[model samples]
Each structure stands twice: as structure tokens, then as C-alpha cells.
Target: MSHSTNLSHHSRRIDLDAPLHRKAGPMTHAMQPVESAGEAQTSQACPTPRYLTNSEAAAFLRLSPRTLEKQRVIGGGPRFHKFGRRVMYAVTDLEAWAGERSFETTFDPEYIDRHPGVQRDDQ
Candidate 1:
């Protein structure tokens, strides 16, 4: 199949920024082209391989980057790595962290019954 047909008809770029509630698939929009501000060039230089910065990762989670950083400091946020002075967020980590809570909604009732909560006589 031709590459053009594989792309969304409404948008040439894949719509990666859409939330997790959307269909699960490879990003559907074409990558947005970015240019370095300091360099002068006639052709569009390729975008650097995108890694989620603190702000970007926070945005991905719909929280402020500072809050995400706080979570990281508290050991409550998604896993991250340091590349020199830059902190890089893993896409898999972000996805896993973002989706992990949803699993709690579909629990096995028998399991919960077996593992009952704090015992109380006020039944």
C-alpha cells in the first residue's frame, strides 16, 4: 500500500497528542516539522528524536510539570532517566503509569471478598 493511504485523510501528521481514551494504535498523524531557532536553513531539518522533557511528560499526563517533578521526587510518578543534566521520560513508563489505575476498576469480586477490608462490628 502507498504511504499516503496509510495516513489519516483529515491530517497528514499523526495525532499523537490525543488522549489515551482514543483508539490505541501507532500515532496516526504525521510528525510536526520543527526548526532550530538559531540555525538558518532553506530545508526543514529533521526533528530530533522526541524524548519527553519534564514539561512534555507532565503535559502528557495532564498535570503541571512541577507537580510531576514533585511526584518524581516523592517516588510516586512514572520512572525516568537522566541524560547528563536532562531528565528524560520513558513513553512506556508514561503509558503504564497513566493506564495502571484503570485496572483497579475491573477487579475480581471473589478476590476482594476473600481479601476483605478492615474488620468492623458495625455491620
Candidate 2:
């Protein structure tokens, strides 16, 4: 089998049976061609937001949907938005909330600040 490739305004035929050789050069975004103006406008006209449902958000965060519902009612959970009567979670908000809980150690200063009742040997 053979394949035709167009590079630098020149068409070349490649023999698939031949052994492939690596070329040392800077990587380029040639594989991803630039979007045309019409395509860009169409995308802009119907932009899709990254919103997840309660169950999907829970799955993404590795938690139970019931836990998220409880948090929504009580407190302590990622930020969420309500669309009419539906609850929605944005990926960015989830990431930010998870980022806030990140700690280098169990006794991290920020963690201690968030949980003042937590006793630390250094205290």
C-alpha cells in the first residue's frame, strides 16, 4: 500500500512497506489546521459550556451524588449553579474547590487554618 502526502506545496508518495525513519525537527501544529472564519463564527455562535449534572459532578470528584446534594443543602462543597430548578456544576468551579483542599501534609498550615479544631503536635 502507498499514501500520498502534501508538504510545503509539494505532493509526495510514501511507500508504507519501507521502513520509517525519524526526522529531527521542531514539532509543528501542521496536523491541526487552522479553522476557517466561517467555522470559527459557527463555533462562537453555539459555544458549549462544560456543565455537569449532580451525578456527573459527583463521579468526576469521586464522591456520591447524595453527598453533593447534602453539601448543596448544608455546606462545604464545590460551587454550583442552578439553572431554573436544575443544579449544575462547572468544571472550573470543581477544580477550584478541589485545589483549595489540596495539602502537602496532614498538618499543613492552610489545612490547620481551615480546621482550627484540629490538633497539631507543633501547636
**TM-score of each model, in listed order:** 0.45, 0.57
Q: All candidates' lDDT scores?
A: 0.64, 0.77
- Per-residue lDDT of 1-123 in model 2, one digit per residue for the tens? 778675778667787534353233322242222454687788689877678899878877879999999999899999999999999998789989988898998678888888867865557
RMSD of each: 14.0, 10.8
Where model 1 places Cα greater than 4 Å from the true spot, the runs are 1-50, 103-123
Q: Write down the lDDT that model 2 would get.
A: 0.77
Which residue segments of model 2 deviate by more than 4 Å?
1-48, 120-123
Q: Write the per-residue lDDT of candidate 1 for residues 24-64, one digit (tens) a residue.
A: 54334332223334432533365344468897787677789
